[model samples]
Target: MKEYKRFLLYGLVVGTVIGFYLIFNLKSFVSYENIFIDKTDFMLSSRLIIYNKTCGLQHWKEKKNFGHRDDIPFFSILSTILSSTEKKIIIIEFGANVGQFSERVLSIPHKIPYIVHSIEPVLTLFHLLRNRSRTFKKEKNDKHFHYNLAISDQSGEKPIYSPSQYGEGSTLGKAFLSNFKEIENVTVTTLPEFIKKYHIKTPISFIKIDVEGFEPEVIRGMNLSINAKIFPLFSFETGETWLDDRSVLAKEYTLKSFVEMLNYFQYDSYFIGNPYLLPISGTYWKNSFDGLRRNPNVLAILRHSQPWKNLKKLLNRIPFTSC
Candidate 1:
């Protein structure tokens, strides 16, 4: 009886210590993958930085060629089309992974966007994005805003799952990655609700969304904004593998829903091909998209928008087609 009593006492003490340790060090335990890479040197690079630091370990690297930058074709086309004097415009980026899209958009060189608002949910990536935005803010003061929240249909808190290998795959929906776990719970808000909460009276001019399989929910939340007179240009990831997994989101709310919504708004949708943005019409989207692999981005443009109006002229100078 005494031996059993001693065993029980030891087990109780061990369990208590473990429980406290986990509670106290929960953050460090969850971010265990950061051990492989140095956290400090991961930010924007210096012009005179000596080494690459990527010794072939990390998948991403810093772009120090902003001085002589070659912006993405889609952004370049939009910049050429939009008048340079067009101020008071806002660019909202969803699933803003470390502000890569924001950085690229702001660095477009020709037609400058008035401001860029970036939203990210992953704790580590959000911190990085907030930090990078500071540098961008320095160059273009008050033009960059960072939000550490997820954008979905409702406003509340939601658990996000992500895999260590694919940190940017953080999603409010089911994580389809092979090795994924519940990373954290992020505060969620609808796009229009967020704008109303912040009292943003300015009209949104552009939007880019890439929320893994949760694009449907994000689309549903844009009910009022979609019908506004000046429809915002959209470049979203639609045919991703996770969105069509059946277990991720319903069929009616997946790609079909996005296309239907675009059509309702009289917005033309295009497949952001390798270099060409091929238009999707009739039953093209039904047979074209192959979500199993990494699919191309989608560009939705209102036919009456300024950019679409000037697209023909820009096409002559800055060719958008590969062939």
Candidate 2:
């Protein structure tokens, strides 16, 4: 009996040691805050915080706090591409899941002059976003418009699966066909109709899209020539696989497709992260599970053929040439 007890005690000690070792070594992967705070000196101070509290653990919650300086990189890059004569800057965001990114933009300093238009299709998410935006305190000059519709190649309604935050939320937008088998109708809109209905004037600035597997449709619907004259950047989320659905296409939607689409529009683009090393490309397959299991998101910049020529002579002092 004593020998058995000793063995049990030894096992407990070993388990404790292993747990502590894991906590120490894998601490960085536990949260973005730990990684960011350790790597940079920047600070964020904003009320809109995303708390992954679907689970009960406190430390397990991942939080993102936005602040003024956070907008510096985005603003500087954008301002360099746009002319000062441009009076109004319009930002169009599709599939704004719950306004998390939108709230981050709204918190930026001296950002009141721009107008934001966000489109979200899921009913539950739309309500959450509307509530959050309506309650959020902001300057009167900053205008925000929300449309509870999905943008696709064609105009019609289709059922979408609005899953609970805990139960495979990653597959929320993709499983629209299977999950909503009974409900065969859902509201969807095309980009052209939205632009016409919104009465968007020329000289647009940015377009961010995050729609789940329907990116190709969204891109096709837009008039690239009109966009080039106005919008300068397109930041979007891309994935290699479409969630199991009827609309799934043959070519897995990927960063390569994003490049091809932009090239078709005559836009030169670069990726934020090394696509070759990303999980989809199979370079980092071992860590693929931990990588972006959902679609990997990227930012694509579109510049005029000769943006430098459009810039004022004095503005040449600023670094406006390269990305």
Error of 2 at 262 (Å): 1.5
Instruction: Report the C-alpha lDDT of model 2 over 163-259, residue by residue, as the tens digit.
Output: 3442222222443344432322357777778888889765556677767657667766676756565555565555433444533441344445546
Candidate 1: C-alpha lDDT: 0.59
Which regions of candidate 2 fall more than 4 Å away from where they truly are?
A: 1-86, 165-185, 225-227, 240-254, 273-294, 305-323
Q: Give per-model TM-scores.
A: 0.67, 0.57
Candidate 1's TM-score: 0.67
The regions of model 1 sitting more than 4 angstroms off are 1-73, 83-86, 111-113, 137-142, 175-178, 224-230, 243-250, 253-257, 283-286, 290-292, 320-322
The candidate maximizing lDDT is: 1
> Model 2 misses residue 135 by how many Å?
3.3
| lDDT digits (tens) for residues 69-125 of candidate 1 | 122445755655553224655778888888777876776663344667788988889
What is candidate 1's CA lDDT for residue 238? 52
Where does candidate 1 have its weakest 10-residue lDDT segment?
47-56
Pairs clashing in candidate 2?
157-186, 158-186
